[model samples]
Target: MADLSIDFVGIKSPNPFWLASAPPTDKAYNVERAFEAGWGGVVWKTLGEDPAAVNVSSRYSAIYDSYGEVSGFNNIELITDRSLEVNLREIEAVKKSWPDRALVVSLMVPCEEQAWKTIVKEVEKTGADGLELNFGCPHGMPERGMGAAVGQVPEYVEQVARWCKMYCKMPVIVKLTPNITDIRFPARAAKRGGADAVSLINTINSITGIDLDNMVARPIVDGKSTHGGYCGPAVKPIALSMTSEIARDPETMGLPISGIGGISNWRDAAEFISLGAGCVQVCTAAMIYGFRIVEEMKTGLANWMDSKGFETIEDFRGLAVPNTTDWKYLNMNYKVVASIDEDKCIGCGRCYIGCEDTSHQAIDLKPQADGTNKFEIIEEECVGCNLCQITCPVDDCITMERRDVGQPYMNWTQDPRNPHREVTEESTHEA
Candidate 1:
């Protein structure tokens, strides 16, 4: 088996799958069970001053199909409901008992240097390995100017990060919020403040649906509802894009990333690694399936790594970065037209119907003398937009064939239909 172990900012874990700071990691009991179930690390749920922090009952809501399959989760929950002293005591006990596991404590508090200083000392005394500044919780905390509030302001992010770095003995990982316009801003800001690493994609603000019966919004609490954070498979694409943006940015490229949001399997984990995430975080999937899912994540990832001959995470990390670039850098001359393999086509006519009605009449469906139908692409009329490829249900039935750039010529540069082109008299004179 290939080595699945990873070292993120001096904290070593036997594998890259670390449970995100959520309900599962709220206490020692849950964390110990996760460790036994093969999770490399757990970020203890966000801890803060207990005197002021109070949580509501019925802190979570879910979207279900008619059959009641959870498609999304909505949480009105704030940080950990447990008292600070109790959480610290549990952390101390868990760390002492499971010294080999990666134990990171998540913290959220008033954006004050004194408050940070006091808490860091208390958390450090618990003998935890590291700390994650919970700047991503979109609900409850934001109302009090805590979670997403500090995260939205890049200056506050840097300021808080600096305080943690200065006062805390443990490595500080800034867990970022996804609500900001550009993820790189806070990422860079955290780096400026001496953050050791950054974890991302806390949650996106969302209203799942409406309660038609009550004539009110969903996840209704006391006949009122505020937008809660959204997380699940739905947020994976957004999370992946944000993670890639920060990883590829030169200003913050070297900073380690803990990829979070919508990761459910080994393939998802591999995608984050290829895009430069040092390790991956999980919450929604684990919550839905339970801790035992880590067993399959670890096994599946290890098997895939061995098959691909990747001896370490660094072997394939950021391998896809070089291929990602701006639109201008994309080769305009490159071309690919959808080609359907006759043998693989099931005569579903899905491609034909889709193309005939909505796209260019590029596909010709012909019935042979033997009463068999086949679909072929009109090479000349095929614009290579790939609509047929997308509509095809069978994988590899339709493939895009790249056309060689015979000459450095582009129709877009000279097309009169292009809105960007100016019909100037000087160009007319040349014409």
Candidate 2:
């Protein structure tokens, strides 16, 4: 089996899987259990100043499908309820007990330098491996001008990150908020502040649904519901896009990134690494399944790595970044035509319906002389958009074939077509 060990900012872990700063890492007992379950590290739940925060009893709600599958997760939950003293003690205890496992404490307080300075002094004394600044919580803390509120403002993100770097001796990771207009802004700011790494994304602001009969938002607290953070599988694409944006952007290029949000399995972890995340964090996935899910994550990643002949995680990390680029840079001359495997076609007509109505009229569907349905591609008319390939239910049934760009006959690039272009003899002599 391939080695699954990873080292992030000098903090070594048996694997790349770390629990996010959520319920799973709220207390010492919980974090210990996570480590025992095969997790390589745990970012203890967000802890703040002396005054403890109180959370609603029913702070969590679920968006379930007809099959009772959890399509999404909503939480009005705030940071840790425990005091700084309790959290530090637990961090110290856990670190001493499991010295090999990574123990990073997450913190969020007032953005002022004094507030950050005081907390960092105390947290560093605990001897935790690292620290993660909690700038992504989008719910209860935003009202205090913390969490997403601070994260949304690029200036505040930079200032707070700088404070952490100045005050803390350990590695500082800035956890980014997904509620912002553009994620690259905060990521770039964090890197400017000397952050060891950045982790994303915190939950997004959302109201899952209202109880129509009672006319109430979800997780009704005191007969009223405010917007909570949304997570789960639904947010994976959003998280991936933001991570890829930060990874590929010129401003924050080469910065270490920790991927979070909707990471449920080894495949998802591999995708995150391929997209430039050095490590992967999990919360909702472990909450949905048990902590034992890490066992599968470890084994699966190891097995896949072995099969691919990758000796270590770094071999495959950021393997896909070079292929990602802006749309304007794309070569318009490149083209692809759709091809269908006759034996593999399920005849679901989904591609036909999608292409015939919504997309470019690329597919030709008609009845054969033998009273059988036949689907063919109109090569001349096909724009090669690949909508049919996406809509096809069967795998490999519809494939896109790349068309070679032929020599241009229009001569648009020639001097004749340009205003600055002098009408040369060849242009003037042409009919």
State the C-alpha lDDT per candidate.
Answer: 0.88, 0.88
> Which residue pairs collide in model 2, if any?
none
What is candidate 1's lDDT per residue for 68-124, written digit by digit as tens? 767677777788888999999999999898887899999999999999999999999
User: What is the per-residue lDDT of model 2 for residues 10-58, given as tens digits with 9 covering 90 to 100?
Assistant: 8889999999999989999999999899999999999998798889968
Give the C-alpha lDDT of model 1: 0.88
As a whole number from 0 to 100, the lDDT of residue 202 in candidate 1 is: 94
TM-score of each: 0.91, 0.91
Candidate 1: residue 396 lDDT (0-100): 97
